[model samples]
Target: MQFHHHGYVSGDPRVRPAAGVGINRPAELPDEVDVLIIGTGPAGMLTAAQLSQFPNVTTRIVERRAGRLAIGQADGIQARSVETFQAFGFAERIIAEAYAITEMAFWKPDAADPSRIIRTARTQDDPAGISEFPHLIVNQARVLDYFAEYMANSPTRMSPDYGFEFRSLSVSDEGEYPVTVTLLQTSGPNEGQERVVHAKYVVGADGARSKVRESIGCTLAGDQANHAWGVMDALAVTDFPDIRTKCAIQSGTGGSILLIPREGGHLFRMYVDLGEVDPNDKGAVRNTTIEEIIGKANEILHPYTLDVRNIAWHSVYEVGHRLTDRFDDVLPDERGTRTPRVFIAGDACHTHSAKAGQGMNVSMQDGFNLAWKLGHVLEGRSPESLLSTYSAERQVVAKNLIDFDKEWSTLMAKKPEEFENPSELEDFYVSTAEFPAGFMTQYAPSMLVAAADHQELATGFTVGKRFKSAPVVRVGDTNPVHLGHHATADGRWRIYVFADTALPGATSSTEEFAEWLASSPQSPLAATPSGADPDAWFDVKVVYQQGHPSIDFGAVPGVFKPQVGPFKLADYEKVYATDPAADIFELRGLDRGGVLVVVRPDQYVANVLPLTATAELGAFFAPLLPERKAAAVLSAATEP
Candidate 1:
């Protein structure tokens, strides 16, 4: 949203001026690239969108499909994904068009009748208020379209190459572009023809039956749950009272239905339980018809009826949970000795039942996590070792997701009478609400994630979790805003300094820290390339524990007023004060002595430290960022 920094633009600011490979980009696929992505699913599209910001890094995506996906099976958008969309600058636009889930209604068989079902419990969505953004219901295709638009408008002008299917690939131990890929044309005049391309790194965002994953010797290792469910999106007249609301209904017998209201008001989706599938049955459950699904739904509703007008989409799938042994081509024995050249993400690495509505949301997070590391390593901002954290961090999260979905899916398939407690399902739903909302992920301590030794500095902003935003007043314009909303998906580290109650010019902790950060070679700010924007590699912002009127703007430290752009204009938006309406200091439990919070490019809190812990802060970033002397050597080596 910050435009006209380099120059004026009367047209859309989203459509950035193309540079590097984006300038008059070749219509034909290039022979070599920095990063090559396969498939245009949620993981692939988001990967391309994130890498598009780095024009200098040549990134290409290829999809086997002839064109964009018309209808996507996934529809649920969690709060965490909405927060990510805000970073990419499209959350508001998508939310305006998508349906916002507010409450969930649970229905159970009536005791008196035993045939008819009655609403037992109604619980609020996100009862814990984990995120400011709401859980949404939007088509997966539309989400892909938004990322596609972002990619098309990015500085790289990156977009997927349709009709290219991955045939095979091999990685060389020594080479500039280590991964040599063989792509076959799936359509057009060049159908059946194969072409060769090479890349420094490759990402497999292809679905469960990914050839890339197979080529890397990784296999999904899990079995089916022997449960089958029939899902359909329809337009119908339903006598069921909670049809418009998200509902979980368990019948007197063994039937059940999960009713979810879709976007565009009238359309809704129903996942009707189709009973258990026998282990010997070889996909016989898939042949279940729309009429049979509707019949099963009617049985779950008892006296209520569904007069179907039209069926938008319908499919039958057996619930299965599977995850790959590893996400990358690096074997266990060669982990520390070798860097990964090929990586898998999304369904390629982990898969589970779609009923939990996590297939696409978790996949997007996978891309967001991997793409930043790719951008950093390829752009020489970070070392190759940074690539190792992607698999280490996301694998744990995927395992946790599969475990939770297994329990949730089982409860949905179970009969009402089978449970010891009648309200077990609803109670479980409320207690574990944060997981489905996509706030349960907490990356364990590693090289990228610091230990929670200083978590008390900002209790609300938990270490290793997403940086929850709170209201702050922008001192420059006296406008109230969520502090976290300013951070974007441009792949830059964020350092937030919460100043103690001290005057701007006074010799306090904040002033001394800022001066050190502005001058010291040990500071991460010193790593910024010469003649570039001062805040290019890192975005440093300061928030004070005081009102806007009480602050002195001119007396603020030079570090906060970074000189950016060609003309070196002082960016004044970096300084902020706590909003009196909602005090961030109190909301996030900031220490009165001041605290320094370091957030990764993916928006997770990387480290939290005290104001005077300058050496500790520098040590945290030292291993991640390249040293000045080493960077100079790399620059010379890369020169033509």
Candidate 2:
């Protein structure tokens, strides 16, 4: 909060840039801005891409490194993340170049061989019908490239400021910027000089050794796995049948090897855990080289030999789990006496083994969650208190991740002999097979999500969990589309109306829904012009159960075809009724014809209600979005 030109105003970024001003342009390191992000990794840049949509808020991303990473770190994109990419319109770009990892085979100790392990378990890597996209194995560098390209092309035209290293930080009400960030120009065109940036909010996406975390006085809690592993990315020549699929090999005596199939000219990544490391050392640094790492891999798979033709990247590091006590903090002014105001996220908040392929995915999600909230506040669309949910929401997720990491990373580090019961490891895999996809993460009820009970309306689609999606064919093109496609992370709410045209009086009920939606003071569509523009605050769609001769577009309510947003019944894109629709109703535990679900920008279900709750719809959006002046006027005119 700051005492500004107007008395005591919270720096709500959502407050749209005053009346006719165009989107904020790339300013020359202004002393004040909206958000300052550190690091150029996926998490940091993804945050930038999210901010790109809100051209009103100013953002600057700085990296100590001179340029972007080329190869060899974080390659797996989880199903949940793939869905996120699809929402942003880039999942196809990644899917085109990535290797899909759908199957896994685990090798355990063989009593006869004594040296090499034998296959003991094989399972599908992803849950069936959980998501439309599969887990994709593409290099982190390639992912970053996609994010960077997207951000650079957005209205904001933003990119990372390279060769700028963080120096110090503080918060001040009197200064031009609420949060002041000091930087030392290490290289690039602007070198050898000090620069300062003042921002309304700060995101510490600076990786494991986070300077932002230190500035906020946040401390890491948790321990590292007592194991050192050498990871290598390479184009290999091998006799392994499962080389293209994700595989785990545990040697009877030596070590364990985890194989991850990759993109780029047929490459694969191997994580060779060489066993126990000095617990106190940060990385368990050893005098090991690439050749030694490959040698360890050879021992794990004795019969299936591996010869690397080109090594993309190699690194040796100890496995560990650590998380910051708090995700955000306040800081004093440069004089060492003021309020704290810095926040940390991504690797700055938590660090764990990368074997599960969660480090980058979770980090990118951290940015995804914070970006919208910050955008809302900076733009004055929501209260400053909305900012508080960032830590509350993400920290729980981080803690859960650390708990799972400690167990999985430990089991993964052990040699076959180290395991007392090989079956226990398999049990662990089966029990938590769906954990890697990241869809199970549920946020506690808060300001954004209602504490309301929705069990009777839709049983399986819980309030806090992600909205379940299923395949359905569009009425016009007859093209099949995922129901989840409507929940893009583009900063708008979604109202999915499942209307069954086959039922008696279904048309009247549908018309009533649209009428109540437009008339209700709390309706989401109340804010949209004629409530039909695709670019409005909210949008709606109907899912007719029966298709073609059974129920055509003509049967839907004429009211459903609002000429407001970009879509209408005439377009047929607004209506869906097709084959294979039972999967959705079954998964959602719906009785027969339909279900109405309210989905947030992040794709979490906020409320589930039957069509009978049409009047309650306005009440749902009342707390979620800004109060509607149009609603107030309508209420006044209708008042008895």
Candidate 3:
């Protein structure tokens, strides 16, 4: 459908125009906007979707392409990215359209016995407790489609601003409300016209060779290796009985290929590395044709033969692994007072090999992390200082990704001639199995503060101290739901009330605790309280010093129950095991709290506040609340 101007200001009379021929028109510019996101790829769309959630924020996305183009790019979606999609309400839909890989078989060609094949089994079923959804295989186009649909239907719908390419950008030094933006609409009849849009902030979600990064003079500092790889998605006729069963197949000739089964019938993907081909020539590999890709696939499979069939899609890419030393390169002269106003994210910030399919996921996450901070800052809920932490948190993730990719590329590039026999390759496999999942390291526990002494507190499971983010812990009985998921849906702020003593007829004091939460300002804490049994909710045991159930209220020396009175701090420590002082202070919701526990939407502790006086709680949480009212107003806003 073509978009026609319903009305125009200045000069427009009833000069009934004809339908067939097009009319020359000037570029239409938006008068005002909150945020201007460049590029409608995964990063751009996600940032738009997130920022659109805020009522005060208005978002506009500019894509060079007119519609969704299915150029086969990235294929696999990591577990963490899937969890992120769940938050956006599109994870299940993606899973339905994608293929589920249950097992991954790694085979190394034997050196001494060249014909022999060494196989080591590593499958998703083995790690049952690690993640709810292990791994999914889906095309990048499908992912883009899902995001496009969500954004179109969202309350903050992206208008007909597509096909508008970014030509230039100018950021302001002042931290005032409006940051001026100059955009050049390079499309249609009025291609040369420049449209200036004044915005509060600008995000450079553009790809690797970002024009925004160039305009701002941001340099990507790291090792840039020239690696050429060919990735194709097509239908193939193969005689190998178990070809579809394998996840990754590495041949002895230093050539690695990945076979992923797609959802629509038997569509599969074949990734092959071209030897000595010019990295810059995109057509060199694509011209090899489907027969060549299938031939390479068959060579990797070796003993098994395959037949060439119809080709659906194909592409060759010159990949690189690199990262910027700084998110924004601000010298000492430009430091303190004037930070770099222009910021780069996604591929612009970091670049890596496509060996493990981490580029897309990391890029999408960069948008997710940065969008919220920018939104909050624009809304004046947080100081500009919060923006500094974005680079701190994301840079570490990018570095870790590069290191993991380097190791994985090394493993994939291992020559079979180096190993003595099939058993030697098996030894290497066993040695590497001890290492945790690559994602675990990327999302593992670390000390919140730079120098924290306690083990639990440093590791991020402490009860009293505040954390930068909350982890996904299995807390329920039958379902074993993620704590972050439940807590995020309930509200940003939560009050975990626990009584030192239990009232009469209360079993574990958890019931009394629930009652207190129900009556307190943070009432209606549980998302599905009715689904869980009342008794099971408070499953913790309330016992005496000798470990026996204490029924008498006065018999218990220092124990306190939720429905009962407060007990000695020493008795409270035995049951919870966390810092008693922190728990008591936090549970009471008292003022001048040492730490203000700020949890992110992902449920990870963002920061911990240690307010010595109880009066600072109001001041700490005032900006974070969505309502934008005083902390005291929370009492009137909470559900009865």
Q: Candidate 3 residues 232-253, lDDT tens each?
A: 7777777655456535566675
Of the pair 1 and 3, which is ahead by TM-score?
1
TM-score of each: 0.98, 0.87, 0.71
Query: What's the ranking of the predictions by TM-score, best on top?
Result: 1, 2, 3
**Model 3 TM-score relative to the real fold:** 0.71
The regions of model 1 sitting more than 4 angstroms off are: 629-640
Model 2 misplaced stretches (Cα beyond 4 Å): 1-24, 174-176, 280-284, 330-341, 500-508, 527-535, 548-572, 578-583, 591-594, 614-616, 631-640
Residues 1-640, model 2: lDDT tens digits: 0013223345642232232112455446667777899888877888888887776778888888788878738888989888888767688889998998777889876788777567888877764556768888888888888888777666577777788899888866775467888999988677989998888788888888888888878888787666788888889899877888788888876788888888865888899877787667655366679898888888788877899898878888887789876788832233223223467878999999998889999998888888887876676566676777778788899999888888888888766767788676767876786677888788787777776465665776788877777776777567777778756556777777776444423555565775566566566655543332422555567776665345555655433443321222132456666556455555566545456788777777877777767666667666555665465433222221
Best by lDDT: 1
lDDT minimum window of 10 residues, candidate 2: 13-22
lDDT of each: 0.91, 0.73, 0.52
Span of ten consecutive residues with least summed lDDT in model 3: 565-574
Question: Which stretches of model 3 miss by more than 4 angstroms?
Answer: 1-29, 110-122, 125-128, 174-192, 224-227, 276-291, 329-333, 419-482, 487-598, 607-632
Q: Per-prediction RMSD in angstroms?
A: 3.2, 7.2, 12.0
